[model samples]
Structure formats: C-alpha cells, structure tokens
Target: MGTTPLTPGLAPSPGSDGTGVVEMYAGDRASQALGIVVEDFGEDWARCSMTVGPDMANGHGITHGGYLFLFADTTFAMACNTEGSVTVASGGDITFLRPSHVGDALTAEGRAVATTGRSGVYDITVRRGDEVIAVYRGRSRTLPARPAPPAAG
Candidate 1:
C-alpha cells in the first residue's frame, strides 16, 4: 500500500482540548467506548490518550495489544482527516515496543507523512509517560471535499 513519513519534533502536549477536529474524532461513541480523549488536533498532526485500567488488561494484568492498536489507529484516523474531510485507513501495521501497565495513561499521536493524489500516509506513536509503547504506519484515502448546502429559502 502506502507508507508514512516521519515529522520532525512531532509530539503531543497536555491539557489542550475541545478542538473541532478533536471533537469530530474523539467525541464519537467509539472513542468514548474506548475511554479515549483527543488532546490535540492540528492540520498535520493529531494526538489522543486514554487511561489503562483494569478493564483494559489481559489475563496478566498488562494492557492488551488490541487496546494499544486501537489507540494508535484512532490517532491515525484523526491525523489523516484533520484537514476537514473524511479519511479512512485502508491499511496499517503496528509494532509493540514495551508493555503498558494498569493506571498508566497512554497517549497516541499521529502525523501525516506523505500524500499522493487521494491517498495519505500516517505515522502513529503510542506512549506511556516518556516511553513509547507502540509505533504504527497507516495509509488513508481522502474522500472528495463536499460542497456546502444551499441557503434556506
């Protein structure tokens, strides 16, 4: 498929919220079901986070791989679509770096690395504190921009 390029100094800051893009992504029921919050949303990048609780743990009490994947994927979705159009990931792969534990707040950030025509590549990183727990590369397809509706009569 496609590949994601890396952005220099790409990272997420804390305490920022309510951005229209973030709201479009994380304010949905899917994000709420996963306990995720979008902390930052920018034209070229996006970030989301969630608390690793008991409910997210595997039999060994460690955060499950699926949770990490979803977090990274969600961030990927937001970053790719931050330009105010619908974006969908067509393919993705994630690498686990370290295990996450209960009570650890996990954050995932994504940056658009490259785009060709209607396809885009995104790089996603999942972190706990300063430690990276996972890294992902995803490809997205951007839908055609929609036109504004006619004014009311």
Candidate 2:
C-alpha cells in the first residue's frame, strides 16, 4: 500500500450509459444510513453531501470526526470506482479543520490524484458552504473480479 503516482492517460472515462457509475454507489447501505447522497460523479471525480443531524453529533454537540471521515470516504469510493471495477480503500487519512454543528449541510468532493496498476490515490475535501472543514486522502486497490449478486427474487 505504498503511494504511487497516478499513471498518465490511464484515468478511466465515464461509463457508456452514464448511469452505471451512479448505480455502483446506490448499493452502499452504510452511507445511506448516514444521510449521504451522491450528488454527481464522473470519471475520477465524485461529489456527495450529508446533513449534520442530531445523531451525527458528538458529546460536544459538534459533528463527530468519524462521520466526517465516513462522508469523505464514501466520496472517495465513488470517485475511484467510476470505472466499474470493485475498489476498496487500502488506507486513508483525514485532517479536521473546522467544526460542524447540527443542521449544517456538508459536501465532500473527491478527485483521483494518482493511479498505477491496481492502485490509486484520491483527495477529498469536506466543506460547509464555501468553507472547507476537512481534507482527506485515500489509497485504493482494485480487487479480483467477483461474481455479481444473484438476481433479486
């Protein structure tokens, strides 16, 4: 899981149907439970949003760091998986710069910074309005192809 420079000219293009990238994120239940919504994504970029409700706040009445990380991680996942490959985060780091209170609507934007072979690096910024609240960096690796889920009953 060492950091590798993103290979040039290797960034995948948007899916042919345009909606395939979005469909990949629709199956994420944990993000949904946290009120995360995928706003837009294409190629190596993704944008997602979440509202800071009571349940997301810590004892100090500010949004928990874990929640912020989760939001950014979800955005990173969407950005890296746009190519239709099953990707997983190998590791990530986040820096908190500001506090978010209840009712604040936070948006995370992620972009692929580098990629080589089966590994990639992404950077995500969490913002409230125009103010940046946190910055996140994630490393991802594409996994071996697995069988798709069985058709819905």
Candidate 3:
C-alpha cells in the first residue's frame, strides 16, 4: 500500500449489468476494493478496467506485479464464471511486458482458451491504453454445483 486507499471517485464499479458477473463482483471485496470496473463480457470472455492508485505502486515507483496479476486474474474470473458455476483458479502465471504507473488507466481483457472436464485455460492481457503491460494465463477448476439449502416452511 502506498498513499491512497479505495477512495471515492473510482466510479462505475465492477459488473453492474450481467447477473453472474454482478453477483460475483458483488461478493468480491478484493476487486471492489481496487476499484475495478467490468466494461463488457460475453460467454467465454470479459473486459475490465481500473486506474492504478498510489497505493498500488511498488518501490520502483511503478505499479506492483501483484496488483497487475490481480487485475488480470479478476478479469479471468469473470470470463470463466459466466456459465453460472463457481470457478476458482488452480494456478496462473503472468508476464509483464511494460510498466504502469499510478493514475495510469489499465484494461484487462481475458478469454477462455479451452475447457474440458471441469478444467479451463484462459489468457488475459493487461494494457495501458494501446500498450501491452502484461499477459496472464490461468488454469481454473469449476466446482460442482452445491445443493440448495432446505426450503423454508
């Protein structure tokens, strides 16, 4: 953490339209706390954006790798969970191509590469406008649907 927290004005917060995305983001304190917004999404893809805050900067004065990974991962989560099943990352990897700074608006877009037998592979690209900042590839596992609780009388 650097100089700022999730203050006001990081408007149009995550997922205000899609039901699954909305629900997922609604319970996602991490993404919300970072002020990520869901720009658009479809069956196997999602696009999100966030502006880097001072709190996300690293000792080198650029945005931290963890924050970049988190942004990409959040977009991946949105893409993989659009089918209405709870999915979680089994593992993921990211490569930083360029550095982003505080106040830099970044966009993370993810798309499913493959899926089979409850496992999925997704690739996420993080960009500062037209510049590619990072690329993330994630493996996910979709959990079995939980049984509903007992109905009330």
Candidate 4:
C-alpha cells in the first residue's frame, strides 16, 4: 500500500468521488459500505463524516458503539495515511461522551498528535453538530513496502 501524499488545499474535496492519497478511499470497501466520506484532509489531518442510519442503531435505539468506533477509526486511517505511507492502526480506544440516534449526522476530525518514525499517535473528535459525541485515540504504524510479485515464468 503506497501512495503519493496529497497536495494541500487541492480539489476533489471529500464527499466527492476521489482522494489524493493513491485513491485509497476509493478502494476502501468498508468505508464505502458505511457511507463514510472523507470530507477533507491535509498532511497529517483528515475530516470524515457520515449519517447515522437505522441499521446502525442498537437495541437501545441509539447508535451502536461499534459504529462510532468504526467511524472514528476510519477517520484515523485517513489522517495517518495522508503522508502517503502505508499506515495501519496498531490499536485504538474511544470514549463516548454522548449517544446519538439515527438521522443524526456525525463528523470525525482526526489529527496526528505526534509522529516519530513509523509510529504515530492520532486524536480524533467525533461530533454531531457542535456537540461532541466521542473522542478517539489511535496508534498507527507504517508498513514496509510489499515485495513485487514474481515475474511471469
């Protein structure tokens, strides 16, 4: 997984159909299936958003914890990978500040708080409007480039 870092303040802004970093988001089936959109990104930061759907609700009639985690995780992925490196989350944890219901639109903004070598710490805030819904922290590691496939015999 390799890609060129996106130029700052470029076009094809999120919610569109493309991204600058190797179009990784374009190939991301999970985010796509969840209707998560990379709304914007720069260098080591990214903003993503999605609307809560009925399917995302738990039996309690509120959004499931897993969905919030996934949304934040996806935003974390976008933030870390902005450097064009093949980054993967080593681990992550979330703290829910409030519960959201279906039909509520939520946004997650992620910033790389610190980066030394291949390791980085990211902080993400998930919000519904001006109200904070959750906060997430993620650790990421950039994977080494994969070896080329064997040549044709």
Candidate 5:
C-alpha cells in the first residue's frame, strides 16, 4: 500500500494560522487502498475508518501488519498535534491481538493519555466492529509555542 503523509506541526512564524497544514500522504493512500478515511478531527482526538479489501490483504489474505500500524500512527499524530503546543512522535509501541481480514470495517481512534510540559502521550486503538484488533501507545514532544503572526503592512 501507499504511505499517508502525517501533518507535521508548523513552526512559530508570522501569519501562521496556528493549525498546521493538513495533507494526505503516501500512508494515507495506503489507508485509502484499505478504504480508510479520517472521519473526525478534534482538539485532542482523531478518528479514522477503513473497509478491508483484497488490496489491503497480505500474502495470507489478511490485513497486513503495516496497515494496522499506519492506522494507529496517523491517529496518534492527529491527537498529538494540538493547538498551542506542536506535537511530534518521539516513540511508540503497538500490540496486535488478532488478525483483521477482508470485509472488516476497521476504525482507529486516538486519545491523549498524559502530558508533561512539552511532551505528551497518546493511546491508539484499532477495532473491527466491536473487536479490538490492536492497541498502541505513542509519546510526543511539543515544541515551544510560536508567536502570533504580525499584522500586514
């Protein structure tokens, strides 16, 4: 599959909208191949969903492990990149519980687990229907706050 471009926190610069640019990257395309779509974006959370298909399958005809990781990663990025404090993933760990297969509609959800100064932690969960397929924990560091944009001349 393709990779989805996770939005990187923008630097503090004049005229910056505060919220960094949001774009779909290679990993997103991979998620799209699995039929994934970001359904919601919020202050401290993000939700993504995808329908499993043959294109998402590995040699064994099940959803590939990478796909699951991407799903959690994307959600983690979204949750960490909050307003005021820019977030970057410093580390993460994921655990797979069961195999997800074709025809399963999987949803990845992420939430803030903890925060300390410029660093924050997020938890991500991947589920098919009501079954939890994977769980992930991500650590992120927020850069120093940027100054607001200067007024135009």
Candidate 6:
C-alpha cells in the first residue's frame, strides 16, 4: 500500500471526515472505557466530553491527573487529524488548575494553534461548567499512511 502524500488544508481521504474520525476513534477501547464522547468537530477543532465517575477518582476522591491528560490528548488527536493525515502526538504537557469531583461533567475543547510541514501544535482546555480545570499543550507529527491489511479470503 502506498502512503498518501501530505497536503496542507486538504480534507482527509475517504472515511477520514469529521464523522469518520469520530467513528474510527470509537474503536479506541481506552477512550470508550473512560466514557469519552466526541461531541462535535470541524477542521482544526474538536470538542469532547466525559463525566467523572468513581473509577476515575484518586485517593483524595478527585479526578486523577492521568484521566485529565487522556481527555486532552484524545481531543488533540481529533483536532490534528481533521486534515486526513495520520497524526500522532510527539509530546505534550498539562497543568491541573483545579480538582474535579465525581459526577462533574468535564468537557475538553482542542484547537490547532499552528501547522508547519508535518508538525502541528494544539491546545486543549478542560472545563467543568465555567470553571477551568486543566490546560494542555500538545505537539503532533504526521506520519505516512499505514499500508492496508491484506484482504480476507
């Protein structure tokens, strides 16, 4: 299988549209297990939400930092891959602003800040109602498309 060439601002190939991206991400077991939902998305932007539950809480009865990072990362992935490229996180950092309690609904909004060559930068904000819970910055690198698997008999 040949890799798709990188084209800036190009729509993703077939099955890579906004809805397709959401559908493809639905196969992610970890995200699904965490109850992450892709609420809405467009070119260079995405919004996702997840509710804090007991399983996601830490010893102090607050939402764990890892869960918050995962939420931001998922949103970043959706925002960067909107252009049809197979983008992966090169690096990321997060700052926890406040503790989130169980039953709190967390929403992560990610937007692309810059895209140069095959690399891009994105920022995500996790919020509970009007309260900011966390902020995340992610760097992404676009990789060549993976070869398709051989057809089944």
Q: What is the C-alpha RMSD of each candidate to the true structure, in Å?
A: 8.0, 9.0, 5.0, 5.8, 7.2, 8.2
Clash number for candidate 5: 9
Provide the global lDDT of candidate 2 against the true structure.
0.81
Clashing pairs in 6: 12-84
Worst 10 residues of 2 by lDDT: 1-10
lDDT (tens digit, per residue) of candidate 1 on 44-146: 5787778886888999888899888888888888787665567788999999989999899888989888998999899998998899889999999988778
What lDDT does each candidate get? 0.76, 0.81, 0.84, 0.83, 0.71, 0.81
lDDT of candidate 5? 0.71
Candidate 6 lDDT by residue in tens digits, 80-134? 8776667889999999999999999999999888989888999999999989999
Tens digits of per-residue lDDT, candidate 5, 33-146, equal: 555566555666777776676766899888898878887887787666635355778999999999999888888888887887887889999998889999999998877778
93 in model 6: Cα distance from truth in Å? 0.6
**How far out, in Å, is residue 38 in model 1?**
0.8
lDDT of 1 at 56: 85
Locate the minimum summed-lDDT window of 10 residues in model 1: 1-10
Report residue 124 deviation for candidate 2 (angstroms). 0.1
Question: How many pairs of residues in model 1 come into backbone collision?
Answer: 0
Question: Against the true structure, what is each candidate's TM-score?
Answer: 0.78, 0.82, 0.85, 0.84, 0.71, 0.82
Candidate 3 on 26-96: residue-level lDDT in tens?
Answer: 78888878888777777778888899999999999999999999999999998887766788999999999
Can you write out model 2's per-residue Cα lDDT over 1-153, one digit (the tens) per residue? 121112222333454232434566557777767777777677878888888879888999999999999999998988888767778899999999999999998999999899999999999999999999999999999998888899999
Candidate 3 stretches greater than 4 Å from native: 1-17, 150-153
Cα-based RMSD of candidate 4: 5.8
Query: Per model, how many backbone clashes are there?
Result: 0, 2, 1, 0, 9, 1
